[model samples]
Target chain A: MERPTLDQIWAWLDQIPDPEIPVISLVDLGVIRDALWKGDTLHLKVTPTYSGCPATAVINLDIQQHLRANGIDKLVLERQLSPAWTTDWISEKGRRNLQKFGIAPPPKDGEHGSYGALLGRVVECPRCGSKTTERISQFGSTPCKASYRCTECLEPFDYFKCI
Target chain B: MADKALFEFLTRIGDTTLVLGHRVSEWCGHAPALEEDIALANTALDLIGHTRMWLSRAGEVEGKGRTEDDLAFLREAHEFRNYLLVERPNEDFAVTITRQFLFDAWHRLMLISLQESSDQRVSEIAEKASKEVAYHVERSTDLVVRLGDGTEESHRRMQHAVDILWPYTGELFTDDETDRELSDRGIIPLPSSLEGEWKTHVDGVLSAATLVRPEREYAHKGGKAGVHTEHLGFLLAEMQVTHRAHPGATW
Candidate 1:
């Protein structure tokens, strides 16, 4: 069998969806920092969305299993935590996918702000694209999200919180 | 260059987060609302993760065989170097928020300065922690305002919590010889120097919340010197029991 290219491995990884938000792939989430093949071994770098995200372990396991099934057995997964992960790293496609999946995408370049920004910022409802939404809580079903209610749609949704 | 000072500094930061994180974790499943339950638990998890990072690095620097778990679970209350403010009992929802708000504000300021430390590892950790602490500050500030300025009953409870927690805040900025040594080397900022910014930030939030700053008096001190309130022992007892009972047991 011809050796699979680095691009091919990434393609395989793209098939593995995030356990929490199954509609989006790990690549879309921007968690997969890098993937490189070093001779016979493949080295992968991953950054979690949050320092304490419980889903990190599950995501690591899933990556290993998915890549191993593709016959690339020698793998090294390094968790790079420096510079920290930010919501701005979420791929454009990931944001769109998250919105389509009923989770509001965080604002781009919303990297630095004060408490006032959190209170005053507006987030459109993912379900209806209605600009009328209010945050119910700064927390949601996951660590990286906030709970918001769409006044127009009368539906509750998660807003991928800006970190 | 004294390694002891460095070790002590690392432990001071680590133990504060570990102990306070344990306190925050206690609110899990018990918060007044579901959103608060998630928020507090999430904050606890973040603090615990930070504890592991700092302690693991401390162990490496100390050239000790102790792991993060060893430092966390094996140490007794007297050995801990956390601030007295953090080790206080979580008396109520109001108290928890009050404690968290004060600590979060100070923590963010400290971390912001630490990001410029001569120690690369410390700076990197501080950078990451500063971001998390910013969110924590925002969350706690919002809650403090909502509770303090909302109903009259809530305002009274919040005021009471502030009165109880305020005395302990002084110890957070009290620098000793170890802190002075580290400060001289630019490895860490003088804790007292950060007090000005802390006061400005904290006072603003309190004023906005329609809460009065408790009158300053004889402030509690000595947690950094391994002296803590009566609450630390019980907290450590409950926290350390499982690990002590089953040594080296892992699922």
Candidate 2:
């Protein structure tokens, strides 16, 4: 069989959506750090969005099933922790997709402090595009998101909180 | 000696988080409000997540085939190395918040100093951990201030929580041989060195909360050398029952 190039592997990997957030691909989520061919085996590096993310295992299994389906059997997935995954790595496309899915994406500049939520900074609601949203809680249904309610739209939404 | 020290250091943080995480999870359905409940559960998740990183490193340093699961689930109470503060039962909402506030304050300082560790692995883990912990500290502080300044009953409970937990804070800064070795090797900060910053941060929060600091500087010790409070055994029994009964069992 002809070997799949790194680019081809990444494209295949991108086909896998984030386990919790289905709207965005794992590649767009930036957890798929790198992929390279080590002779016959494909070496892939992934980082978790949060240390205790329940989706970490599911994401790994999904990746394995994904690459295997693509006919690249020799594979190794390494959980890289040094750089640590940050919301900053979410691709521009991923942000747009998250917003379209009714979840507010994190700001691009990431200037928001860890205590940014306490300061009453505006998180524009994905639904109405209103800048009048208030955080309902620091946590949401998953570890990576915060709950916000828009006064203008009267809708509760998830904010991909900056870590 | 170095690997032994590293294992000791890692397990100290690892086991502490494991115990506290489990305790926090106990509040899943029972917290004061639904939002607080979800917040506690997520906090527990983050702590357990950190437990994996620290215990994984400990297992590597020990060079044993034991995984993070083994380190977390298989160890007897005496074999555990977490501080006494974390193992205490979550007596009430105030105590839980106060306990979290104290630990988060110290934990933040510890992780910050660790970011400069001579060991890159240590620094990297600390760097990543520091970000998550920033959120923990902020939330706990807000709760403490709110409850402390809120009402007569809440104010009394918050103050009582602080008074009761204050003694344990000293043990957090007490340095021993394992700490001395790690600090000497530049792999971690000396526990005593972090005390100043911890106190400063805690003092600021306590003042803002209108809670007074306990005058006593005396502290209970011995968690570092494997000695632990009786509370740990019960907590462990509940936590380990599932794992022990079904060795290597997975859903």
Best by DockQ: 2
Runs with alpha carbons beyond 4 Å of true place in candidate 2? A111-120
Screening candidate 2 with a backbone cut-off below 3 angstroms (N, C-alpha, C), the clashing residue pairs are none
Please state the error at residue B3 of candidate 2 in Å: 1.5
**Residue B86, model 1, lDDT:** 93
* Model 1 CA deviation exceeding 4 Å by range: A1-3, A113-119
Candidate 2 residue lDDT tens string, A43-79: 8899988889899999999999988988988989998
What's the iRMSD of model 2?
2.1
Q: Write the per-residue lDDT of candidate 1 for residues B103-216, one digit (tens) a residue.
A: 999998888899899998899788777777777998899889999998999999999999988899998888899999999999999999999989998899899999999877
**Which candidate ranks first by lDDT, i.e. highest?**
2
RMSD (Å) per prediction: 1.8, 1.6
Provide chain B TM-scores across all predictions. 0.98, 0.98
